[model samples]
Target: MEQDLGIALPLDYKELLTRFPGGVFRRIEIDSPVANEKAWTKYKRALDELLEILGDEDLEYLDKVDYTPC
Candidate 1:
């Protein structure tokens, strides 16, 4: 799936599955800042949407996560 997206997903992303098993899409941590604040905002908004969808689908799965952002 990552190959089709032309991106490589980190092995640990499976950790997210333990919490929100429906899964995430498109976003990844990167070394560089977004090109501009607008881009950063958009990125954050997208992540928020992903989290929202995951929450709606299944909250229990999230409990399986061993780690999460602080």
Candidate 2:
């Protein structure tokens, strides 16, 4: 998945995914600056709308955050 996304995920995380497949644990919480699915989707949609409203500069600003769009 990381390879398909052209991103480098942590080795431990990759191992965990390999071993568990479903996830590390049933209800594990990940706390990081990285945005989760819902937040990322919402942000991307908002950015797309903002690009229409505000133009390319808004996308450039968003790009500065260095998030990988899902």
Candidate 3:
């Protein structure tokens, strides 16, 4: 993965992926082959919405953006 990304990954990240596959840590989801489906579905929807709002010029979304869902 580091070779493909052209960047060296952190040691902690490598440890976490190996030790906590498909698990959540500090409110963050770790991607794995067995990730939670429901959580990912909601996450994807929110990400798409956020990207769309950011792409919009007149939405004034930055000031109104909320992170409670996260």
Candidate 4:
């Protein structure tokens, strides 16, 4: 799935998916990096909604974060 996405997921994220393949947690919807077709579509929809809420200003602020590896 990571290969299909063309990005390597964080180790912890990979571990979490391994622990819970369906990606459900306490009945809350947590987007899975390894989601199947249906789950991926749902994830994308949620992401689009989140992006809409974030707007350009919020995204610019987020882009300024120092994502450098420790």
Candidates 2 and 4: which is better by TM-score?
Answer: 4
What C-alpha lDDT values do all the predictions have?
Answer: 0.52, 0.52, 0.61, 0.67
TM-score for each model: 0.35, 0.30, 0.38, 0.52
Show the colliding residue pairs in model 3: none
| CA deviation > 4 Å runs, candidate 3 | 1-34, 59-70
Clashes of each: 2, 0, 0, 0
RMSD of 2: 9.4
Per-candidate Cα RMSD to the true structure, in Å, reads 13.5, 9.4, 8.0, 5.4
Q: Tens-digit lDDT track for model 3 on 1-70?
A: 4553367878887787667767678999665522456755665677669877667756554457654232
Better of 1 and 4 by lDDT: 4
| Candidate 2, number of clashes | 0
If both were scored by TM-score, which would come out higher, candidate 1 or candidate 3?
Answer: 3
Point out the higher-scoring one by lDDT: 2 or 3.
Answer: 3
What lDDT tens digits, residue by residue, belong to model 1 across residues 24-60?
A: 2567444211345564466567776886777653567
Off by over 4 Å in 2: 23-70
Question: TM-score of predicted model 4?
Answer: 0.52
Which candidate, 1 or 4, has the higher TM-score?
A: 4
Model 1 scores a C-alpha lDDT of 0.52
Give the poorly placed runs of model 4, Cα more than 4 Å off. Answer: 1-7, 23-26, 29-33, 56-70
Strongest candidate by TM-score:
4
Superposed Cα deviation of residue 63, candidate 3 (Å): 15
Clash list (residue pairs), candidate 2:
none
